[model samples]
Target: MSVSFHLCQPGGGASCGACCGLYNFRDHSRAALTRRLTAQTERLSRAPHTPEAYGEAARELTANRDAPALFPIVRVCPLLGFLDAEHQRVGCLGHPRVTGGVDLRDCGVYRATVCESFTCPSFGWLTDAQARLVQAACADWYLYGLVITDVEFVRGCLKLLEWELGGPASPDVLRERPDSLAAVRRLFALKETAPGRDGQATVFGRFAHDTEGEPTPRSLDYAALGTRAAPEDDVVLCLGYTPPDAPALLAARALVRDHVRAVAATFPA
Candidate 1:
């Protein structure tokens, strides 16, 4: 189930800390996460590189964590922070590569071995091309992690595009053509741009926590909305749409349709 390429920190302006529980917080918006990571980076940069100092800093950061995890069961690491002075990348600050030959990830939420070995579902679910396209489309750490970690959102968008084109919407092709890649980027940008999905921090794209605190895939209540299911519904749900009624559902579908069509339009006529 291993992918041919690395999805985490694949370069070309892409990096991810999602496996470290980057997006587990309730307010995982770009602004909130930037503040959190910025604070962590600044604080850790001043601490001694010893395990004792790093562990204490980790505890203090967790104790003063800005927001509670949306999923209580998930572990959010305090060691995740911006890897660059410009704050364009996010990664494990405790990694030996960042800490100048000292591995301090053991001081974070998980052991160093676990952090080194763990691979998210994306490693298996996403092909090299798909992963590369996501990397290319989302250059910023915040948006890159948001879209790359969600395999369903990436796959759902591409599948819908294939349907719209009445043919294959190859990820490799999209990656090569600037115009097509730009269009595809707009489609993937729906992860952040889709409107009216606020106030539902509990809802992570198509999945929401049940009473037991486990994620469960949400479904469109067609019977309640009086509208039948559509192809775009999967992407719509992955976009975190909880449409209240038929009109709302249709609007969400239309939003997805426009983006999908835009990508398809870039194909040869």
Candidate 2:
């Protein structure tokens, strides 16, 4: 269960700017964000169980609305800060200043029970090498991995890929299945309609395939999972990338599409 977080790392080349500033806060108002910061501050300040470092950082961030180092140009979470003037590097202000130390998750501000329990759907299930490759893609700043909604199905696909490739599904697998690149393109083209509200047919079952072009943020709708009725509950699928020349990534992408198509076949039109 090797877990890698692009946003949590400070000097890590793959750090994410999207989570705090770009899309995550798109719907949040200033007042709402302030309320959230205040709540997090309060949680960090609580007694006996509180980490002194977290409390201090949270209080400082909450009290100073215009903390220059704490606020990025994008106006994201107060906890975010840049290591360089160019803002090319960014990380959590809540983190200890110690060099090569632990991340914000290990710090006091994030020790709040709710924050401790939170896990993004996009966070798990990859080999260390796979994780590094994904992070490299994410370095483009325009790229982010999608969360797979059908975790079991996706895992199954990965397992099948590994079996077919005769090892961990590394980029090297692409050499054996050069056609996988084309398969990936084909999979992205397949779509189906799912029943939306009031008997309306909503088109879904397509996965994003373009990793080299402009970044397109998309969500998955598991219309095949007829038991679940809400879009939020739908299984998500994450698209990860390796270099365009890497065969494993192409193979993995093709496998994902093939699995998705197989799953989509199970649902009633």
Which segments of model 2 are wrong by more than 4 Å?
Answer: 1-7, 10-12, 16-23, 27-77, 98-109, 112-124, 140-169, 172-269
What C-alpha lDDT values do all the predictions have? 0.89, 0.37
In candidate 1 the C-alpha lDDT for residue 193 amounts to 86
User: TM-score for model 2?
Assistant: 0.36
**Candidate 2 lDDT by residue in tens digits, 30-108:** 3444354444444443422334565465555547543222122323454544444444444444444522343453343
Candidate 2: the clashing residue pairs are: 54-109, 146-238, 148-236, 148-237, 149-235, 149-236, 171-248, 174-247
Question: Best candidate, TM-score-wise?
Answer: 1
Alpha carbon deviation, residue 226, candidate 2 (Å)? 12
| Candidate 1 lDDT by residue in tens digits, 32-105 | 88999999999999989999999999999999996788777789999999999999999999999999999999
Which ten residues in a row are the worst by lDDT in model 1? 1-10
Cα-based lDDT at residue 149, candidate 1: 83
